[model samples]
Target: MKIETQCLHEGYEPGNGEPRALPIYQSTTFTYDSTEHIGKLFDLAAEGHMYSRISNPTVDCVERKIAALEGGVGALLTSSGQAATLIAVLNICSAGDHIIASSSIYGGTFNLLDVTLRRYGIECSFIDPENGDAAIEALFRANTKLVFGETIANPAITVFDIERFAKLAHRNGVPLVVDNTFATPVLCRPFEFGADIVIHSTTKYMDGHAVQIGGVIVDSGNFCWTAERFPGLTEPDSSYHGVAYTRDFGRAAYITKARVQLMRDLGASPTAMGAFLLNLGLETLPLRMERHCANAERIAAYLSTHQKVEFVKYPKLPGNAYYERAMKYLPLGASGVIAFSIRGGRERAVRFMDALTLASNVVHVADIRTCVLHPASATHRQMTDAQLEAAGITPGLIRLSVGLEHIDDILADIAQALEQA
Candidate 1:
């Protein structure tokens, strides 16, 4: 089936004359017929769920749906997007490991890797994606376990070169992890371009209504874990009774370890109710993304020519920096988000956002309702001027997230805001 059909029918299958909607398996524990049967589950010999902390029927369905959408072998749902990143890295990396990440990632993720992960002995080197291949590759060392980058960067509105990065990682015997949150699977499936792992914060377009907070990690099951490279997977895991992941689970070693080991200890599993809502969002993703792209293209064109605007950045827009890469990766469109600079600097940008009536000046992005944010002052306020430049953030940059609203109304709001600015 195509992605649109898979979104609606991939994971859950109904019995004869049963309910069509995905059911929420609300129980915390499952019952077993005999003690010996339960023992097999505890020993990993059986695949039945015994605790909600590890898995649930409802959440499992969502995971499967996401896995199908991303063309991955398996997926794991987390309580939030942040947890997904943490688990995705920790599954392979240890205290002394290193990660090479693009500097254009979301600010929250930047802090997580540069500060929190460093606290745990995991060090990260942030490199600008625009840097030449040699400069970026030189950051990799023997300790480098993986390469991390965003598919369509958050506020920067730049697209990462997935095929290049994936090749760079594969050459160094490391997996390429792509955060495809902004450009949902409907627009671009990173796995098709050699990405080994894919991740998303379902709080974004996946849950278009902004109802639930969730995240998903999908493994393509392509990367091999040799003892010399990824000892964590090829070596015996003592916590699971000397079980080696690659030896037993084969293609699913990476994801299985994330669940049986990481999830078992950290417990960042999503609630069954959240999964139900996310499924609802996934059902309409294809339709909503079409409208989002259409509206954003019109808005970007308007912003580019406006008297009060300095420049506009939308990968789908012609003459934009990432238009070529976007055409290669996101032929459908570059999702809904766009970035533009008001003529005046920070003060003028804030003035324009405040003047808007239809579009909200909120802290959120990728929602069904149009929203705007000033990253330099709001999201990336903590960054110094030098740091902001490195992240492709200008003081006057306005991150405008186009919504599914009608083109006329959305344009009218922007026209009025530009007049005020």
Candidate 2:
């Protein structure tokens, strides 16, 4: 089935007398008749959920749907996108390991890698995506485990060259993990372009209604894990009674280890209710994304031509830095977010946002309702001047998340706001 149909029909199917809508299995534990069967589950020899801390029926259905959507062997849902990223890294990396990530990622993610993960002895090197192959390649060390980047970088509005980075990572014997939050599967499937793993903050496009916060990590099952490079997968996991993941689960080793080990211990699993809501959102992702892209395209064009605008950074716009790359990767659309700087810098930017009557000045993005944010003072406030510069951020930068609202109204609001600025 195509993605549109898959969104609705992939996850759950009701039989004979069963309800048509996906049911919420809200209980925390599953019951089994035999003690031996429960042991099989505990030993990773069975396909059943024993505890909600590990998995649930509703959440499992959503995971399967997301995995199918991304063409992955399996997926694990988490409480939030942060938990998914942390678990994805820790599942394959250790204390002395190194990570290479694009400098233009979400600010919270940058802080996670640059500060929190460093405290645990795992070092990360941030490289500019446009620094060319040689510069990015120089950051890789023998200790490097994976290459990380975003499909459409948060707020920066730059498109990541997935195939280019994937080749770089593969040449160095590392897998490439991409954050697909902005360019969700509906827009771009990183796996088709050589990415080994894909992740998304369902709180964005997948949960278009902005009703829930969730994340998922999807394993492409394409990376070849060996004892030499990934002992965590090839070696015995004492936590699971000495089960070697690669040997036991084969293509699903990485995700299985993530679920049974990291998610199991960290307890970042999503609730069944959350999964149900996410499924509802997924059913209309293709439709919503279509509107989002159309609306954003119009908004970007208006901003680019506006007299008060210093510059516009929408990949779909002609002559934009990432226009060619976006055409290749995000042909369907560049999602809803647009980044443009005001002419008079930070003060004018704030004035414009404050003057807006329709668009909410919220700290959120990709919601069904239009919103805007000043990243430098809000999301990227924690970053140093040098870090902000490296991230392609300026004092006047504004992230406008174009929603599904009528284009005329959104533009009218922006036009009035710009006049006030």
* C-alpha RMSD of each candidate structure in angstroms: 0.9, 0.7
Point to the candidate with the largest lDDT: 2
Per-model TM values vs. the true structure: 0.99, 0.99
Full-model lDDT for every candidate: 0.93, 0.95
After TM-score superposition, the amount by which residue 279's alpha carbon in candidate 1 deviates from its true location, in angstroms, is 0.3
Worst 10 residues of 1 by lDDT: 378-387
lDDT by residue (60-159, candidate 1, tens digit) is 9889999999999999999999999999999999999999999999988998999999999999999999899899889999999999999999899899
Q: How many steric clashes between backbone atoms does each model show?
A: 0, 0
What lDDT score goes with residue 258 in model 1?
A: 94
- In candidate 2, what are the lDDT values of residues 143-220, reduced to their tens digit? 999999999998898999999999999999999999999989999999999999999999999998889999999999
Which portions of model 2 show Cα errors greater than 4 Å? none
